[model samples]
Target: MSKYVLIGSKGCGSVVIELAMLKAGAEFELEEIPYLEPGPDRDRLLELNPLGQVPTLIMPDGDVMTESAAIILHLADAFPDAKLAPATSDRQRPAFLRWLIYLVSEIYPTSTFSDDPARWQLPKDAQDGYKRTVDQYRKTLWGHVEDVADTPCFLGNDFSAIDLYIAVMRNWRPGRKEFSQSFPKLTEIADNIANDPMFSGVLKRNFDT
Candidate 1:
């Protein structure tokens, strides 16, 4: 049996990877870290991941993996029975890769900036403006996602890791209420996943809502 260890923070994008592992029925140990400042936990995390980011997975063979999208995609491939992703030969595979990459590359960076605007080294007077710009961009990005979303889910009928990722990311920035109102289709997909028993526990555990 392959051992899996996930180091992550609550309310962070890492929640999606954690949920994916659970839904996959993959046995894994979770280590939570504090984001407030550098401390013992963060120090320990750096030893495994030089960047010290959460959702770092210590694989059974002792290799380390980072980035939420990469980690979940790996899980989906490793545990085919979990059905977290479409098979490479599946017609939806290309679209799946497209949206997944879009979320990580486009939307995910905004969330990071929104969470820690100071990281950008903007002048004090410019911080709020930078955040506002990022917020508007995030909203527009989500609208694009809504435009192409399939009914009942992002990939239609089936629920995959992408939906799980969207569900968690929706809770950030504009938050659930505003996010739902702005992007109804994407919100519907998120709502479905939130209500689903497989994901409810992880949601409550991370977001407490």
Candidate 2:
């Protein structure tokens, strides 16, 4: 693709995908708009992403894609030079994909809920319901993380795209750091991946933007 335009938002898993694309040195352009507010840009993003969300990628030929996990995988699989994915010979593809899906499908959506009445809909009265829902989903996602705790890097020793996806997805908790600090391994990995140069500017671009 001549240009890879990325439609992303703050505190979203899309940041990881964009970071991976940047790390891979893939030849593509980034198109991200944070702050869920909309104008012409939001409308354009909706044209590509029916959900009206971020992590949308537009190819040079007008092909549009949504979903952060898929975006990261597509970039790595398409570019061998990037080496964001594992080798075909490796047998961890199954586990790698599992966590990738977990982050995208399970954890990413949980952030949309809020205990704060200022953030979500319903009413000041329904804030507790929203929080309860968020907790259930968050716990489920963490359980998935524990289930596959045996594997490092999600797909073995290598740092695949899944690692990047999870790191960004988990940043949503805000207080998640203090809470998940109990999980030593995950906390360590989070810190390690967060420290990578590939992700150095990603937090700023994706979260601070």
Candidate 3:
């Protein structure tokens, strides 16, 4: 079986990629390295990813891969029966790739900036500014995706890895319904993914574990 050593926190979006693997019914071993102790994970994932990011995939042949996008796309390729991705000849392939990359390159980065605004060092008076910068970017990011998601899903009628990544952001800001309200279609996609029976156990076991 392929061995997947995920080096991230429970709250990290990489976990959604892992969840997609499980949902695809792929056979793989699981390992977790908490983000709180990133050094050990960084050192450990060197063979898999020089950058030492989580959601790294170690193939059965010992070839390693890193980055959430690469990992999930690989999984989709490996599990053809799951059909998490569009076919190569499909007309939607181009648009799908566009949205998929945008989620990682654009939306994911914005959420990261806001998720932990306090990480940046600043004077007490400047802390609010850092936080405000995060808020501004978050809204900008939300508006971006929501505007483009004119259909049921980000990829326009297909539920791809993009939805999975966005759903994890629901808990990022926490304690406010408006966090998701701004992005109506994006939020609906998140809720659909989270509320699905296929993901019921994952959503339930996620926070509890």
Candidate 4:
């Protein structure tokens, strides 16, 4: 069996994990799941993860892991040579963790809510408002990151999982064009990743860009 198995769908946030694995040169199998349509594949995914979420990683020992940020961090630490994250002793480690968690905790939820406003349980008539609110919040979160982003990437010149996360999220609501116009710095980071041979192929495979 491969060292790891990643269950994911195209264009999902899971693509960040996929790109991280590719950069790390990890030997892993990709299991594509139809996350939107209910079928055998989705059922199989649910069997492994009750949440039926993509980006579920199955270790060789049969342990299952979920969450895009956690999986990316795990891969970074597991394969130190890849330098996908800052070392624990590095001064930038704190900043790295901070932005990564902020993206996962603060910004990620906005995409979830915007994508499925009904999940918030707001009145049917209020669904559009919910989406708009989430969209505005996403822009606000990215704006804050832009203001503090001093380097070409999120954590200096080095390309880390944080950049991959930002690049993937940039494709979400307020899409690439609008997002680029609003936060050129952040867009530059994503563009750099999107243009890199190491990552561009994976990005294109997942997003068809």
| Superposed model 4: Cα runs more than 4 Å off | none
Per-residue C-alpha lDDT of model 2 across residues 13-78, encoded as one tens digit per residue: 567767787777866666657536768888887777788877777876779877776676777778
Regions of model 2 farther than 4 Å from truth: 113-123, 150-152, 205-209
Q: Can you tell me which runs of candidate 1 are displaced by over 4 Å?
A: none
- Model 2's alpha-carbon lDDT is 0.68
Candidate 3 per-residue C-alpha lDDT over 1-209 given as tens digits, one digit per residue, 9 for 90 to 100: 44555555566765786678777887666676664464766566665566555666677777777777777778788886666777788787777778778777876676566555567656677777776776777777777778878556777777777777767766665323776667778778877877787775665565541
Q: After superposition, how far is residue 159 of candidate 3 from its true place, in Å?
A: 2.2
Instruction: Give the winner by lDDT: 1 or 2.
Output: 1
Residue-wise C-alpha lDDT for candidate 1, range 1-209, written one tens digit per residue:
27899888999878988889888998898877774468888888888888777888999888899988788788888999887889989899889989999999999988776767778777888888888898998999989999999968899987778899888999898788899889888988998989989889889888888
Error of 1 at 85 (Å): 1.0
In terms of lDDT, the poorest run of 10 residues in model 3 is 1-10
lDDT of 4 by residue, 1-209 (tens): 55899998888888988888888899889888778689998888889889888889998788999998788788888899888889989888898889889989999877776787777677899988878887988898889999988558877787688888878888888788899899988888898899989889888887777
| Candidate 2 lDDT trough over 10 residues, lowest sum | 174-183
TM-scores for candidates 1 onward, in order: 0.95, 0.83, 0.84, 0.94
Best by lDDT: 1
Lowest lDDT 10-mer window, candidate 4? 111-120
* Candidates' C-alpha lDDT: 0.86, 0.68, 0.69, 0.86
At residue 40, what lDDT does model 1 achieve? 85
